[model samples]
Target: MFDEGVIKFSCEWQKTEPLAFSGLETLMGWRDRIFAAGLIGLYPNGIGYGNISLKLTDSSFIISGTQTGHLLHTEPQHYTLVDRWDIDRNSLHCTGPIKASSESLTHAAVYTLDSTIQAIVHGHSAALWQQYLNVLPTTRASVPYGTPAMAYEMGRLFQEEGLAQKRCLVMAGHEDGLLAFGETLEQAATTLLALKQL
Candidate 1:
């Protein structure tokens, strides 16, 4: 879950920055909704995966750190910030020493491919994953994560499911997990919740 301090900090950061009001409000609103929905967890089968992030600028974005959970309770400054592949440093940056989530690259890819997408949420949900596995052809066995290959596979599925308007995908090999993106964080969160209810 998100810390109160973090939520407050995020609110302040958005107010001080040149970001859009709707996007920031959506991000903050989802932070609360995801936590209240009990979507973040630590147990093996628990829904402990996923992060929400917002674009700070065209070439840069801010995302929750690895395993940080959907609800960020800490200060916003504590969250990780990532940028396009450096023409020089060759690595992304984070607020602390911790590495960003492996799926960070996936988030980056979504933003790169869809300029309208302002928020991205990725999580492991038993219900959604089960649906994907039950529906996917048996010939496909494994699903990749945090890799370009996985992104491509998901992109194909998105097309197949007529989900381009929805912008969400479930990974059959990854199990009980899915990724959702939207023009705002609220939309992404709402889509994820809707899938879980189904």
Candidate 2:
């Protein structure tokens, strides 16, 4: 109970101006659809689940802020920029009106794995997780979410489990957790949407 939305890393957060909404139109639009689909939403415990992110550079990205899943809609202020992260140290540095999402490090791991991966969508769905668990490149259940172990597990998936080609994997230890990523936000979101049909 109450396992989601807690930041597991040492985050250096700076309160700054809200991010401009210009380049986020596509991300936000897909987020709206994902939330409406009940993929990213509030749990009964009031903890928000799921997060969306886009690569801004090789080392920087914009992600929906932590605990923002309760919102039916989000604004620029609800997002943050993760400018730096050290997965081995389990540390992150970000700037925005809000802190980065709890899954920032995991997203950071994905970006670090490949230069072409430009977007990542982390969401929850019992059916999808159950149906695809182990059938897809999956993390071991021993690794918890938002930690260096989990981040490394992502690397394992890519190096050993063909995750880059699969483009999605189940977080076996993280209940109902699934991540989809691609070269574009559209591909990332569509990958998750496609899983709903299987």
Candidate 3:
């Protein structure tokens, strides 16, 4: 049986200042909508953990910032735009008042795998996650979130499970973690919600 005592990956992250500036107004708008829907909001237990991202260009994407203690309440100034990346090296370049989400590298890996993806939604919902666990492509449970290994695991999914065509993933390692991406913000967000209906 699997044991939580046997944690497999590190949680440490490497953060840096962005070398380029990218606006986040649109990203924020989508975030507000998602937050209001509770897709990335605080629970009755006073806990919240989730993120969203928007592809900026060929080499960058903007992701929601860290410790969003209250996803729905965080201002646009708190969002982060990753202007550059070196996922293989677990390095990132971005600018904003707050740092990138811990899953920034994982998001970067997705973008690196498919240039066509323009938006991403990372939500946490246990019921939807378990209900569709077998229906969607998933990462191994041994790989933890926000680390280089987790990032590579995401890239591996794209290669082995037709993720380029799927544009979504259920992270087996991270409890309740689900990911969806598409050519536009609406598409990605829709995909995420569609998972729950499945």
Candidate 4:
């Protein structure tokens, strides 16, 4: 069940005008289109797909909505804020209206683990997911999604597999999904798009 109030709040936040970055906006737009196209192509059979999320300076993050499909056709504000946990504001108790993607915690975790990471992207692709699952036994237990436990597991995996230095991993339970993060949105989006080719 989607909460209307949260949606409205998130929409408002996204609508708030900001200083323009024509060059960055142009690049991000191109990245979004490329990433979206790659996702669509990878999921041609259409089992699942992925989207991008970005962390701005004010602690608010821009995340694509749940089940929005790829990223190309979606409106800009369709990307909403997953609240920043403001410790001074009784963060845990302060639940605002807009509901971010169910995997918002994953995005949050990446930023929390590394302040340098400005963007994160998660997606579902058949080959990549299959390869990840096939290699899971060689790694530790499978990586899950949509839960705090999974986020913790991912953190552990990052440290153990030396993926902390890298910016991506495959979420086994999500069925064809991969996670990628980077110092900038373009880097993350580019990595995600390239992973499909590798």
**Which number leads on TM-score?**
2
Provide TM-scores for the models.
Answer: 0.69, 0.98, 0.82, 0.69
| Per-residue lDDT of candidate 4, residues 136-187 (tens digit) | 3212335445555555666676777766665677765565667777887778
Question: Any idea what lDDT model 3 has?
Answer: 0.73
TM-score of 1: 0.69
Clashing residue pairs in candidate 4, if any? 6-97, 6-98
Residue runs of model 3 more than 4 Å from their true location after superposition: 1-23, 43-47
> Best candidate, lDDT-wise?
2
Model 2, span 1-198: residue lDDT tens? 367889989999999999884568877888888999888999888899999999998989999999988888888888999998999899999999999999999999999999999999999999999999999999999999999999999989999999999999999999999999999999999999899976
Q: Candidate 4, after superposition: displacement of residue 40 in Å?
A: 5.8
Candidate lDDT (C-alpha), each: 0.56, 0.93, 0.73, 0.56
TM-score of 4: 0.69
Alpha carbon deviation, residue 187, candidate 4 (Å): 0.9
TM-score ranking, best first? 2, 3, 1, 4
Query: How many backbone clashes does every candidate have?
Result: 10, 0, 1, 2
lDDT of 3 by residue, 109-168 (tens): 888877888899888778877976757899898888777888889778877888877778
Report how far off residue 36 is in candidate 1 (Å).
Answer: 2.6
Query: Least lDDT summed over 10 consecutive residues: which range in candidate 3?
Result: 1-10
lDDT of 1 by residue, 20-137 (tens): 3234555556755765665543444333466677876777776665556633453443255665533122234444333455566666666766678888877665755677554532
Q: Which residue pairs in model 2 clash with each other?
A: none
Considering lDDT, which of the candidate structures 2 and 4 is the better prediction for this target? 2
Best-to-worst lDDT order: 2, 3, 1, 4
Off by over 4 Å in 1: 1-29, 44-48, 70-72, 86-91, 95-98, 132-141, 158-161
